[model samples]
Target: MSDAASTGFSADWLRQREPFDLAARSASLALGFRAALGPQNPAAFRIVDLASGSGANFRALAPLLEKDQEWRLVDHDPLLLAAQRSEITRWASGQRWHCHDHEGGLAIHAGPARWLVRSQQLDLARDLEDIDLASCDGLVTTAFLDLVSAAWLDRLSALLVRTPRPLLASLTVDGRRTWFPTRPADQLIADAFLSHQGGEKGFGPSLGVRATPYLAAHLAVAGYQVSTQSSDWHIGREHSDMLLNMAQEAATVATETDPSCKPAVSSWLADRAADIHHGLLSLEIGHLDLLAVPHFPVVK
Candidate 1:
């Protein structure tokens, strides 16, 4: 998934991280979200995915739903929105499902289950209010919360409270990172990355790793029962490309955050590269998945 901010994410990067995202997500939270939707018409079950990226969240959750569904994928980047149909179509085809263009979107058929997907381009920072959560059975987002500000989360919580729908937010970073065979500059690099994470990403100052806790508190205060679970990424030696990307990005951020650390960051990156070459490197990045549902009054 991608952030709603104007800082567009590369589709290639999103694709590369998708498998890890899928593996890290909490199936239990998905089940809880499905249950919260209750006994709705199977053919009319609807979900709205925020910052939908190339539709990874839809692909991840659709099978779990096991019902005929409609998904509205909302994102700020037209590039990502444009990529959604092809990605979903390819995925459906791989699953031996029938997929075709229908009404400017895509319709997918998997045995008795059918999914209708459509894309909408909206600047989430400005057009968040335009999403009609009341019309959807559920609201979902992935890898997006960390890019938003506390006030943005507050607005989201207020919206959810008013709409009273179940929400599943997956793969939000939780600030923890572990690298195998730790090096001397590891903490320095991590601290730099964390600082970079707090920089503006088109959503004012980002909440970064603090996003989930802040949002959870707001939702709880609004009478929504919230649950969270770890969704950390465990990158192994086999995932050399991913590890290399992580190391490179960290080096870039570290240098940018403190130019004086350039030599140290470069040395660290070189060592990590050697580790990847020798199949001696591994990494774990902490993330959290959250599910929140409004409390419903029981009838006597």
Candidate 2:
């Protein structure tokens, strides 16, 4: 339930899926990110996150990084931007970290390490060129790439070509959907849902499932050593609420994609709902996580 759907996702939905995202994210690419950014050891690195809804990227990546860091979270939604400070502060408090608000942003002190987190409001689709990629040590985005068209991704790759940086784009859907108790309509609904994914998420008809591989090729042509891994979501019986929400959303999107599929989609949802209540339904959603770095010039 990230921006991959092309929707300006609700903050509540963001909160709901965060734990699943944390659990499903790729492990190796995180190590790859660490390796990519570790050598610049003089001080904390400045990282920019594109479409950073409520600083979820920060909440996830900050602790994994050893150095004190400065982060910029960019998104078009003013509401989510405003929510970042309160949410992060609350989250840190739960972890016993001391958080303080300053003139510009919030600072979290976790024993010896401190991180400065700030949010910027911008329409990345319209202002991609306005971002100063050269100023940051790296770029990050999660559940965002699938919302963009191939041309938009090419623009990004071209910028990174000029100013090489470590880029971690994670949790993009790869078009695979599986449901337990395997109803006959499962594939039809999934097909329609995938079709709906391509219908304009403010980036002019997204590539949806093709996003990761498309970006990987583009960045590779720009001299980036691109790597990818599976970051599939495994929703089991424990997440009945999330599973049901996903079912409803899928049905809605499927109907929008193909009006003729409504009857089938409704039946599927009803069956899935019953299965959910009976603790019999589950899902495996396929997503990809990508890590890219300049292979040519050695950050000189």
Candidate 3:
């Protein structure tokens, strides 16, 4: 995946934007998870976080579970994973105030935590084959699905269903273009850009806002019950500027896909950027978070 697509997990742009906070949205998901598990009694539940990325979700999820529970994080970026480990170590070493779940004795396992995060070093998508799927109680990923194509989602969904555990995914799809301070012209540009992004991913464009719905339908058809909710970034100046740049890039991509869009979309983006620069334009990026769990099959 390109740096832009992976930004939510890897790019300094999003790190600067504080994707770790994005994991807070998982609170509801964790509740849904406990509900699905129906009483966290005996054995500690095991969770696999795909594209774990600096342990953003882990940070959010760490405090909410039983200490004995094991969190098996998977990410292609070793650097981020290392950073995650560092954070974990820092927290683990802290006194009562540092540990989020001291009562639970939470253990932070680090594959490699320290230094620059690398991608190819730990590709979860392909490396996951070695995992014992049946042993996992739950699977999770945040701000990840939006970067994948429908085909990729289908493949992932199939793998998810094949596992003997429920899947709790949080894919933050960009919905800001459709809401307040929304520039109709910029919206069109964004659409064009998403379409181009799809092509690059081997999926035809037009899957932007529809990704969650599409995924839900796919999972439901596979015999899983799904729940969805909207999570807004509530853009501050920094976030708004970051999103503005993203919008511009998406618009540029759209213009590239269809040459005719160049004259119109380009001018619109330039003006939009100028307006943003002048503190006259603003937009909030909306994202959808989805939770999917298996409908426990009848014992009969």
Listed in order, each prediction's TM-score against the native is 0.96, 0.96, 0.73
Report the lDDT tens digits of candidate 2 across residue range 1-300.
534333878788889888889998887897788788864687887889999998888989888886788899999999899889888998999999999976598989977888999889899889998888877888999988988998899889888987888999989999998998799998888888778878788888799999999999888877789999999999998899999888888888888788897888888889999999999999999999999988875463
- Alpha-carbon lDDT of model 1: 0.89
Tens-digit per-residue lDDT, 1-300, candidate 3: 223343335444435455524533647877887667544356566667777776666656645553445666677666676676565555456523333333323344332221121122345444556555676667777766665667667767777677646677764665554423556576676566456545443233325556788889999898888888777655444445565766566665676677887778777777767766666654555677788878855121
Q: Which ten residues in a row have the lowest lDDT in candidate 2?
A: 1-10
Residue pairs with backbone atoms closer than 3 Å in model 1 (clashes): none
lDDT: worst 10-residue window of model 1: 1-10
Question: What overall lDDT goes with each candidate model?
Answer: 0.89, 0.86, 0.59
Q: Which pairs of residues collide in model 2?
A: none
Q: Check candidate 3 and list the clashing pairs.
A: 67-104, 76-122, 79-117, 82-112, 82-113, 195-205
Error of 3 at 280 (Å): 3.8
Off by over 4 Å in 2: 1-6, 298-300
lDDT of 1 at 4: 25
lDDT, candidate 1, 87-206, per-residue tens: 888899899999988888799998998899999999999889999986888899999999999888988988887778889999999999999989999999989878877878877899
Instruction: Report the CA-based lDDT of candidate 3 relative to the real structure.
Output: 0.59
